[model samples]
Target: MSAVLSPGMGAIEQAALRSDRFRLEREGDWKRLDAIVTRIEKGRAKGLPDEDLLALPGLYRAVASSLSIARETSLDAATLAYLEALVQRAWFQVYGPRSSLGEWLAGFIGGGWSAAVRAIWIDLLVALAVMVAGTVVGWLLVAHDVEWYQALVPGGLGETRVPGASAAVLRETLFGHTEEQGMSVFAAYLFSHNAQIAILAFALGFAFGLPSLMLLVQNTATLGALLWLFADKGLLIDLCGWLSVHGTTELFAILLAGAAGLHIGRGIAFPGDRPVLESAALAGRHAATVMAGVVLMLVIAGLLEGFARQLIDQTAGRFIVGGFMLAFWLAYFFAYRGRRQTAGGHFA
Candidate 1:
């Protein structure tokens, strides 16, 4: 004869039966997902067929649904635990990052940085205009009043680079004697100074980019003041040649930094339909990538400033080097088409 059961015991028995039935119905898909995920995790998925690889996502979603159902229906403890584990493992294989560090770096250099730069084209244009205007403003200020030179040029250059220095003195400063041993130190110092400026420009982007634009204007204005001083002595072309060696790279880096800041500022200032914080975060990610590349540009500029500018004394040679670099950077950022493209069919 069958034994009698209490009410609680009867309920438990019915639940266990339902859990067993549920597992049986879905266990095949669960097992398939588990096998695929396992193969990938174990580095044995290279030979996995296209069909199986394609099926993996579908299988994962089905198992995830099963897990959710089990929890809601109060399935047996063992079944619940098993589905939880399976779903978690499948989630990683289905959605986790698959690239190694080397792969990531290669992609970033090949296309990611350039794509990010293109994404903020509007901001870049604004920054370029601001820089050009600033330089002109600087020249006009010094041209109108010679006394403005002292205020615009930094104090370190006052001894030799004042407004009224003789042509001999100004020429000597350009083709000055150099200590080979001090070249590295000088390069390091330039790098440090440029890096500081770049960092400040990027960091100040949160205040709607006003501060970043001001910083750019301030830096370029100094450049304008120096240009006027050289132009006054009829050495405008000579000064251009002298600065071309490294100024191309250095100025480009600053331009990008200012643009990155402006991108963030624009995001916050005009968030559109998205929440302000979310829009800022998206812009920040793009800006951060651009800034990372800017650091590399600054390092190159430093090397050119410290060594190439010193070693290449001829005006023509300096322009050649500088022009080649500028061409290279332009092609790399805007011309190269890589394997990965964003939604708009541009490299990313």
Candidate 2:
């Protein structure tokens, strides 16, 4: 027996047939685009033939156009949905700004960080001068009165590293016994401690920078007091050697942190023609980039402090390692030109 459809039923059937025909005509391009997008997403794009790679943009545009037509012509739900997904995927493959993690890291190390640092040269100079002043202030305060040592040095170090801890005892602290197994733990602790200082220095910048400046001074004053202690005991050179191993990187990291904070403070304090918040936001972005690099610097410092400083017994050797690191940083930040610089003399 043959069945006959009513007029309404016939119209619905005709629509279904049109939708199927539409999908059949465009499904090939859609599938090809899907395959290409899949390969790229899975990191297999390098294996794709040159022709397929070259045709990606065209395929994307075609799929996008099909999606538009599908939406306007009120096509079947399945065809519309498939076109939407394919177009979206092809759109990303064609015009997305997505980059792999390794590529991002490479770009950052190559020029992004150094450029940000260079952008804040003025802040760096200001921070350096302030730090030097802080060290001197610390030294002078302690020199005028031995009691100031107690105030400047943290209580944790005060137990053994006081004003008159005796030459032998103080010297021992500089060249203490080390267990290889414990070095890792010690390094982690040092990283955590220094990171706190660096981050605090940066985070405090939101308060118009006064707190940040004071923090910088206070921290360095502790260094100055320690320097005086060792110097008075006639172990100044030895102490210098001990510190140089990790101090170069550690101090540089702190310096950047302090500079970053100062930049934000300065922006807020002196917004020029821009609104205070706008200026601060700009400064924050620039400083944030510097701070990101500072974290990496701190990691290196931790390794040096925990391992290199412990393993290398010679004062000269420590200085050599420290000096090399300092020189490397200097060149990378100021002299190295890995990419073209922008109008502001920043790497782009």
Candidate 3:
């Protein structure tokens, strides 16, 4: 061997070069070993500590074993190549672990709640404004001609209907299913509606919670109008019994979905210390979890709407079911959630 003067030569580089030759000579797989070793040396130069380097020997061994197995098993060339790539990726991920689920959930809920609360206040104001506007418009409609108003609201001055004869028949047809049949064809309607509501709620977040708030108000007003109609027509008690069976759960889910939309909107409006993009991402995850819970609630509501509500026509039975659903929601949100906290202090 002849010594050649090179200004670029360094102690660590020389050591790495020697290490590479030794590894190749011992392993007799210079091509692959050299490439992996070169990458590790570069990482070390970039401040990767010794612990990471020491950890790599095990990773290399594992990859070697996996490749040997693949060869022995006669795996297809493409598959074996993919497995090799996966081994490298898994090695880095395992060594440099990232955030855990609990951490992610905490960040999501913490940031999401802050954002949601701000947006919710604006949403409430918007809702009140819309209700005032609607009231004015409704008053005008009624004032224009009492006879026309009477036509629109068949129950007249204060009458309303719930689970109208046709709606009840449809509910019966949709919900009446044997356990052996397992959800039947009508179950599709329930699932699809729940999915549709969730997607709409999520998509409307782009509108800054305005759309969601409007949707909630529109639905609430319709319910209010119906109730007023029923009361006018001496059917208030009957309508209450008809609605209470599934309305408690169904309405709660819709409201929660609206809340999620509001959360996303707030994240966009006020990012606090975080970048808007990051805040939005965090909000999205929390909203997703909340939306999932809403979907479940909707499923339960659908079941009650289809089967239990129809089966129990008694006013007392409907009241009990509705009361229980309301209690459950209040306890979960106001009681349990209120008791939790963040890293800094108690939750709001």
Candidate 4:
């Protein structure tokens, strides 16, 4: 025979009954929600039927409420954990970001890169002007005094043609020096050297873009002086053929990078209506994409200068390759982009 329980004991017994009743009332819904949430995780909600999908947010809210009530009522640990886990998964499905990596990549390729280039067109034009001016000055200086060749061109790059070299010597260097060892060494060095300049031009824009401007001038000046050297040797056509293969892309890549740096500098130096920091941050976001593309261009330039220049010794062939690449880039950026933006707008 059992002893008689006191009123407080009876109240404790009833509270336990109430907690059990709460779990019993909600257990089925919790399990169903868990199943749907699991399916969502696996299938990304694609397999979920309409009703089941519609019910998810409701179920999520129900589970959240249940979790709160369980904590307040001091429910069993197992039941609380079950509800907590369910709610977590459901919350993510309902409220977290909805984009996938594939979607973002597709969007970026579709219009993001080109759109960014178009946005900074003015800065790019200015950068191009600066480079052209530098080239002209370099050409004039070298033409006036051949000694300036020693000052403008690096010792390594100058190894092929020098201050007092004859036309015969430059011809030998240009058309005859396709020997394996010399060509290999020169190509490797040239690619590595230009890559450094390309990266530096963009990186140095922080010094009020002045440093980048100077670098552009120096690079262009060097080209001009080299042109004069080849022209003096009566090998201007040959030199043009050699450079045409990769110079178009390489020069454009460097200018784009310089433009990126300028964009950042302008933002910081003149934030206009916004705060300096915020203006800079926004400009950086846009310029960074252009810089990334510029790096890609440099890599292509390096490859053309390396293997193509080595194998295709004909000047005509080099020009053809360069022309094709320029045409492709122009069409990709303008033609394709313009088709989408009609007189009003339309895709061709």
TM-scores of the candidates are 0.77, 0.70, 0.53, 0.69
| TM match of model 2 to true structure | 0.70
lDDT of 1 by residue, 1-348 (tens): 433444767787877767777877888998888888888888887679999988988998899899899989989898889889988888877776567667777778878888888889899999999999999999999999989888877764547778779988899877754545435544465567667777898899999999999999988888899999998998888889888899899999999999999899999999999999999999998999899999999889988888888888889999999999999888988897565533222234
Best by lDDT: 1
CA RMSD of all predictions: 5.8, 8.5, 11.6, 8.8
Structure candidate 3, residue pairs in collision: 158-229, 158-232, 158-233, 159-229, 159-230, 159-232, 159-233, 160-229, 160-230
Output the TM-score of candidate 1: 0.77
Q: What are the lDDT scores of the predictions, listed in order?
A: 0.84, 0.83, 0.57, 0.78
**What does candidate 4's lDDT look like per residue over 145-227, in tens digits?**
98898888987774657867888878766565455543366667777777777788878877777888888999889989999
Question: Distance (Å) between predicted and true CA of 67, model 2?
Answer: 14
Stretches of model 4 off by over 4 angstroms after superposition = 1-105, 177-183, 338-348
lDDT of 4: 0.78
Which residue window of length 10 is worst by lDDT in model 4?
339-348
lDDT, residue 27, model 4? 80
Give residue 201's error in model 1 in angstroms. Answer: 1.1
Cα error, residue 44 of model 2, in Å, equals 24
Give a tens-digit lDDT track for model 2, residues 152-256: 886655367787689999887777545564355445655676688899999998888777788788888888988898999999999889889888899899889
Please write out the lDDT profile of model 3 over residues 1-348, one tens digit for every residue. 634436688965664554444333434332444355556535532355566545555656666675676667554566467557656654554453334667545644544343333334444355446544543444454445434344434232222132233445433332333332333333345445545655576579867677766665454544555455445545567667767777778766766677778778888888899999999888776676667667678888878766776676577877899989889765555444322333222243
lDDT of 2 at 178: 55
| Candidate 1 all-Cα RMSD | 5.8
Residue 214 lDDT in candidate 2: 83
- Give the clashing residue pairs of candidate 2, or none: none
